[model samples]
Target: MSTWLFDLGNTRLKCAPLRDDGSIGEVVAIAHDDAGAWLDALPTGEVACIASVASDARRVELLDALCARFARLHRVRTEAALGPLRIAYAESAHLGVDRFLAMLGLCGAHAALVVGVGTALTVDLLDAAGRHRGGRIAPSPQLMREVLHARAAQLPAAGGEYAEFADDTDHALASGCEGAALALVERSLCAAHDLLGETPSLHLHGGGAETLRARLPAHAWTPEAVLLGLARWHVLRIA
Candidate 1:
């Protein structure tokens, strides 16, 4: 029987087939607002495992669409404890499942600082023992640009190179927004080092990660971290 993994985030829906060896296959990302037309094109499978951070209405719409396409649907949620991972949240439900799963995918022998750059900038720290040490959330550079452009139409929303000191308005906007996000990640790394008494491995993911990853070359980039974690979640459940 075929099984597929779905990661539904605020801006995109990423899906991939589960390979026989339990690894995730190539990922296909779709915009939630325009996903209806593409649903029928997806290969019908025996089971669909989904981890979603989209709104309730959007999730229902997707579930309704996939009802007939898969024999069973496994929707994953944030848990206080899952396998080796122990979430730090007092109310686990408040933590986005994407963040939880991303940590799961990145967690291993060493401590890690997981950074997600998408519609929002999110950072979480996980110790070697799989204990989540909490995290921070801020507006992503793209989102900051969008909000600024929306508030002030004169500022261009997209375009401009990142610079330490930008001469023009467009570059200034880009520099300021991107700089803020970069500073946050750097600060988190410093704090993680101090907290752990050792430099934790940095893991980057999400659509906006490439820009940040470019600046920080040493960090690991796992674009499919969420899906990989979902696969792990499924295996543990069925084991």
Candidate 2:
């Protein structure tokens, strides 16, 4: 039977099929600005699994559409503990399911520092034993630029390149915003090393991940972490 997984974020919706080997097949991404018009083009499947962090109204619209197409729908939620991973959040529900699921996608015996650069930059540290050690969230590079332009008026909200020494305003804005994100990742890596007594494996994902990848040479990039996690959850829940 064909199964589909959808990961809805603040800016994008990524959907894919789950293969027999437990891997995500060709992903299709739809921009939130398009208002899910592309959802109508998706093929109906036997099962649909979703992890959403979009606004309630948007979620309603997406859910309504999916309900019409799929026979079974499973919405993944954040939990205090899953398998060997134990969330440190006092109220586990407060943690975003995307982050929790991403951690689950990378779960293992080794310590890990998972960084997601999407509409927001989110960092979560999972120890060698799969214990959540807390995390941090901050404005993403695109968000920083947007906020600055929203306030300053003159600054452009997009189009710029990152550079060590920018000679123009556009490049300066890009460099500054991207630099801020890079700095946070570096700091988190240092802190994770200190707390874990060794350097943890670094994992990066999301739309902004490519922008930060070159700066983070040692990090592993897993763009489909959330979808993979949802697929895992589907298998476990059904079994």
Q: Candidates' lDDT values, in order?
A: 0.88, 0.89
Minimum summed lDDT over a 10-residue window in model 2 is located at 33-42
Name the regions of candidate 1 deviating beyond 4 angstroms.
Answer: none
- Pairs of residues clashing in candidate 2: none
| Residue-level lDDT tens digits of model 2 in 1-239 | 88999998987789999998888899999876555676676668888888999999888778889899999988889988877779999998899999999998898989999999888999999998889999999999999999999999999999889999899999999999999999999999998888879999999998888988887859788999898788777777763
Cα-based TM-score, every candidate: 0.96, 0.95
Residues 53-88 of candidate 1 have per-residue lDDT tens digits of: 888877887787778899999889888988889999
lDDT of 1 at 120: 89
